[model samples]
Target: MFAVIKTGGKQYKVAKDDVIVIEKLEGEAGEAVSFDSVLMVGEGAETKAGVPFVEGASVAAEVVEQTRGDKILIFKKKRRKNHRRTNGHRQDLTVVKITDILTDGKKAAAKAKKAAPKKEAADGDAEAAPKEAKAEKPKAAKKAPAKKAAAKKATAKKAPAKKAAAKKKED
Candidate 1:
């Protein structure tokens, strides 16, 4: 059976045990990931299509490796302008092996368990010790008044000089 799945703004036609290099996905090697945006599923002459996405249809895969594509050189030039720019880029990619395709809300792999929320303490116990407050370090001492005044005077002197230089350049 073959399935068409959409992920990372692209569609791929995949089948069981197929290895494909796709856009980067956040998962470690050997981690299981499911693609729920199934566009189509086919087996021999029987084919099932989705209006947008197939309801309860998903494709499961195992992350095989995380790698990058080949570097592509980008060059830009403007004739007679003495302007030229060059850049190179390599796209992040993930290699995955398609494990199974499931329909009708069935899951092919076990889902990760969510963390349980912490319980709050009851209000009736007055003897229950309150949560300890975080200790904050003392703030640094302020600069001396004489030093601050000197710094301010230095900046004030430089500001007018900068303005004068800018006006001279414009003229």
Candidate 2:
């Protein structure tokens, strides 16, 4: 059976055991992921489609590896102008192998739950925090250069004179 699955803003026709590269997904290699936005499913002449997306239909896959797509060169220029830009880009991708296609509320394999990390206290650090309230250090204030401040005051003083001169000229 073949299924049409939507992922990474694109649609792909896949079947069991088929491998495909899609946009970067949050999973490591050998981890299983499911695509629930199944658009269509087919077996020989029998076909089923979804209104937007099929309800209770899903495709299960295992992450093969994370990879990058081919690099694309972008060039821009304007005739008679000395403006040109050249750049390149590569898209991040994930490779996955299709494992199962479930329909009618059927589920794939049971997913493994990740264990939470345990917190360990250092020697005497845990006892110190509860016994004493730590005081915050004062941040150092930034100081501006005296030369720049004087220059700014000189400019401010000259601005009124310049405006007066402009008014006299206009009159």
Q: What is the TM-score of each candidate against the true structure?
A: 0.64, 0.65
Model 2 per-residue lDDT tens digits across residues 1-171: 999999999999999999999999998777789999999988999999999888899999988898999999999999899999999999999999999999998999865533212123434377765554342222222234666788899888754444433434553
Model 2: clashing residue pairs?
none
Which candidate ranks first by TM-score, i.e. highest?
A: 2
RMSD of 1: 11.1
lDDT at 106 for candidate 2? 91
Model 1: residues with Cα > 4 Å off, grouped in runs: 111-171
Cα lDDT for residue 129, model 2? 55
In terms of lDDT, model 2 sits at 0.85
| Candidate 2: C-alpha RMSD after superposition | 11.4
TM-score attained by model 1: 0.64
